[model samples]
Target: MNKISIGQSELMASQISLGIMRMNALSVEEAKTVIETAISEGIDHFDHADIYGKGASETIFGQAFKKLGISRDSVILQTKTGIVPGIMYDFSKEHIIQSVEESLTRLQTDYVDTLLLHRPDALIEPEEVAEAFDELEKSGKVRTFGVSNHNPLQIELLKKFVNQPLIINQLQLSLTHTPMIDAGLNVNRTEAGSVLHEGQLIDYSRINDMTIQPWSPFQSGNGKKGLFFDHPDYLELNKVVNEMAKEKGVAREAIAIAWLLRHPAKMQPIVGTMNPDRIKAITKTTEISLSREEWYKLYLSGGKMLP
Candidate 1:
């Protein structure tokens, strides 16, 4: 796997990270095998969220880690917090500290390599968040901080008060759901693609040296249903991906991920597949790089039009 430095942090994260959101569906033994398979394929970064499987996912992963007898420092564990399920989003100092404490207990680790606010809280107070971060950092509970599903101004709101660097911003991005890329390509045009829905997020991330972590890389973002593969609306995209897979001698998923890696932003895609075989197949993305012409072809195949 290729390693990219996360923003200005010292953590050199893997280009592709295994998301444990669906790990709750697997038994302890199965989860262990999946993790081992990813590690064997050079995937060292694991992504998690506090609300995933109601926290059972992290618990199962912790059990798997203990069963494997691996050292704590051998891998990077990143988790998100602040979502209270059906209740509300909480960024209060008390909730932030309590959430990480519970996550640490469930993960069988003393500290997380990184902690993120799962989503924005409309009623959030930035100073309260800053205080919570300060306490966590000083106590060695969380090594770094970040946010997920936050727009550029939302990040700036937190950065105004939080002392630690907000290094990563996780967003939903895929070939079909690509307003970030589309807005840039269609600048000054009257087309719908020219309207900025994400507020120059890609450019802001690149300019600020923050890493953009693409979640649900295979899923459509604009209220579309299910994975992009085999979707009726994405027949053209499937055709192009299949053709590239045939030409590259790799799985279709590898071509999909390679398209994200082709961008100069150096995005880290969080793949949530639990199948070990599929994980291994997708790991081959590091071996292939998409050329500019091929990248545009795949983009257009996804139903995007250039001005």
Candidate 2:
């Protein structure tokens, strides 16, 4: 597994992340086996969310780790908060503080390696969030800070109040679902479809030295959403992926991940498979580097290329 440095932090993370959102459904022993397998494959970072199954995911992880007696220092746990069900967004100092306390208890850990704001809070007061993060860091509750599904301006807004360094921004990215990349390239004033990203988030992240964590890297960018496995719009792309997989002697997933890793932006794909075998096989994606032309062809194929 290729390692990427987390800003100035001592933590070095693998290029791929194991997302434990579905671990709540798995038994403690089963969950432990999956995480153990991931760690064995040099996957130390685990992505979590407080609202996943209403905290069941964190509870399952906590119970499994406690039973297995895995040391806290060996792993880096990252979880997000600020998404309140029925209610919109939340970044209030009280909410951030309460959420971290709850997350720590559910995860059965003294501190999370990274804490990301799940989504942007419309009424976000940077001061409140900054204060919460400052206290969390000082209290040894959270080691680093980051955000998810946020654009460049939102991050800028948070910067005004946040004294701590925000080094990671997780977003939805795939060869198929890529407005962030395509919008800037396909410039047409008359076409409404040309408006992509509405913000230059990818470039902003790279410029600021923030880690770009791409989730749902295989989703089909078509009429249907989140259906990347054998998706119709993804046929050509999957074909290329399968072909490359055979050439590289790795699984098809490796090809999909490579498509993202091959980018100049150096994206870290957040892998969500619970299967240990899949985890080990997908890490090979980082090993295979697709050529520049191959990456572009796949990107153009995802869209009806304009003349």
Q: Choose the strongest candidate by lDDT.
A: 1
Please give, for residues 170-268, the per-residue lDDT of candidate 1 as tens digits: 998888889899999999989999998889999999998889999998997579889999999899999999999999999999998999999999999
The runs of at least 3 residues in candidate 2 whose Cα sits more than 4 Å from the true structure, single-residue gaps closed, are 188-193, 304-307
Give the distance in Å from residue 36's predicted Cα in candidate 2 to where it truly belongs.
Answer: 1.0
lDDT against the true structure, per candidate, is: 0.94, 0.84
lDDT of 2 by residue, 92-126 (tens): 98988899899999999889999999998888889
Candidate 2 vs. true structure, TM-score:
0.94
The worst-scoring run of ten residues by lDDT in candidate 1 lies at 216-225
In Å, residue 183's CA in model 1 sits off its true spot by: 1.0
Model 1: runs farther than 4 Å from truth? none
Clashes per candidate (backbone, < 3 Å): 0, 0
